[model samples]
Target chain A: MLEKGTTAPDFQLNATPDQKIKLSDFKGKNVILAFYPADWSPVCGDQMALYNEMLKYFSKHDAQMIGISVDSAWCHNAFQQDRKLHFPLLADFEPKGEVSKAYGVYDDEVGESKRALYVIDQEGKIAWSYLSPTAVNPGADGILNALEELEKK
Target chain B: MSTLKPEVSSSDHIEGSDAASITIVEFGDYQCPHCAHAYPIIKEIEQAFGDQIRFVFRHFPLQESHEFAFPAALAAEAAAMQGKFWEMHDALFENQYRLSDDLFEELAETIGLDVEQFQKAILEDAVKQKVEDDFESGVRSGVNGTPSFYVNETKFDGGPDELFEMLKESAE
Candidate 1:
């Protein structure tokens, strides 16, 4: 995975069937890039749902979160609507895992993205990064802590 | 593994012996179906273990996904004002499928709380802050989802049923 202080690689991925979101679009604000394996996991350990609840906290730090997975835009749309998610889940489809690969989070064995988190500062430098075990949900505390640290700079 | 942050304190809703060797802290959402499913299993665990187990519940309501979750947590906190926190907690999960603003009142009356006081308490800013505090603590403690459990201050990597198995084996 990318290390802190590195310039985050920019990419454009599909946020929906017709809408494309670029990493550069969020240049002025802090960005949280979350790469997860898949959606519609069991109800108990839902990583996305946990993040959805923390949107207010994330915004309080002037940060926007984006989720990336190998799933198509249609799949992300269904999952987002079902979970009432307010943020975007970018589809790393078409080329398949291209964005995940750029960040060194793609898993070739499973043909999906690994569970990873990256906090990018306003200047697009990686402020923090974590590669969580596939079975575990890394949660929001790390991201929040990273954002708090950014405020001190 | 993630460990419980801040630790269980006077602010938590607790049950079982104060000096119990095993402590279970659960961060749960009231409107979540998975938590409702774990409710009865938790009851059974408490019954089987008795004094050896200490249980604490903290609200981690996913307000966006579960629309009524925050309100239900508020109702429980309101009931706490009348010394009926567990009663309201159980009632909320037992009747989760029918959770609504009205159901809170009905459950309050059934749990024998003063209806007028209950209504007033739920709207209190302090009560809302209490629930929000619980949520913030949960996030800081690395709670991944509703019904996340911490056993002896360390995160338990599985569901309630798996927790039950571990408890039973420990007692053997």
Candidate 2:
């Protein structure tokens, strides 16, 4: 998986905003990239909700949060509407797990991404990265705290 | 520009009056072995902290690997429709492996749910959507796996005891 201080790889992936988003777009700002397995499970729901609840705090810190999954944009659209999600849920549907593989969160055995979180600094380098086993949720507040610490530096 | 807003449905908003000062949010899969292992520890933490801590569970089913997980999640939600969410939740974890359709019916029976209503609810695509929504939320929140949790919004990277200690300190 992507590691702390490692430069984030650049890629243009499909997003709900009706266009492609590149890593460079958020340059000069902190970015929280959350990789989840699929849409619509219990723990996944709370995870996004927590982030959604903390949106203002992330914004105040000049950070952007983006979620990536293998589900199609159509599925993601339905998910966003159903949950009233405030962030973009990127579609890693085409090219079949390309983005997930780039991030090293892909599970070759199941063809799905592992639950992972990466905190990328403004310089486009990874400040922190975490990969949880197949049955856990990524730590959101830890990412937030880490961001706060990094901001002080 | 990426804007952030409260992304959760109003119903899911957890309400707790605990001044214990610590909250743990878990993302788990019912059929997941690790989750089954973690369930008791979570219960222990809840018992240990009482009102001093808040514990929330989010669903992250690995559908590709665990075909029964999605159905199991729907069953729990169906039970939730009748105010039996916790009972069904426990049943699912307790009977994690036998998640087949027949077993779901048995669980529904065990949980005192109207078998017909439970079966009907399971057949409804919308009920599945509810579980799906939770999974999507997990993905959006950056959950890449199951049985993962956040301690007062900080990710806990250790075992149950490690998490328990962190929760204890955060409560202070």
Q: Which is the leading candidate under DockQ? A: 1
- lDDT, candidate 1, B6-55, per-residue tens: 79999999999998999999999998898999999999999999999999
A55-136 per-residue lDDT for model 2 (tens digits):
6668877999998888888888897776677888888888978988998999888877778888899999999887876665
Model 2 residue runs over 4 Å out of place are A1-153, B1-10, B13-20, B169-172
TM-score versus the correct structure, for each prediction? 0.95, 0.53
Please give the DockQ score of every candidate, comma-separated: 0.69, 0.09
Candidate 1 C-alpha error for residue A2, in Å: 1.4
Instruction: Please provide, for model 2 over B20-133, each residue's C-alpha lDDT reduced to its tens digit, 9 standing for 90 to 100.
Output: 576677767788887888888888888877887766666667654566877788888888777787788889998876767678889889879998998888878877877776
Per-model C-alpha lDDT, please?
0.93, 0.74
Please give the TM-score that candidate 2 achieves against the real structure: 0.53
lDDT of 1 by residue, A43-105 (tens): 643899889888899999999999999999999999999888889999999799988999999
Question: Alpha-carbon error at B103 in model 2, in Å?
Answer: 1.2
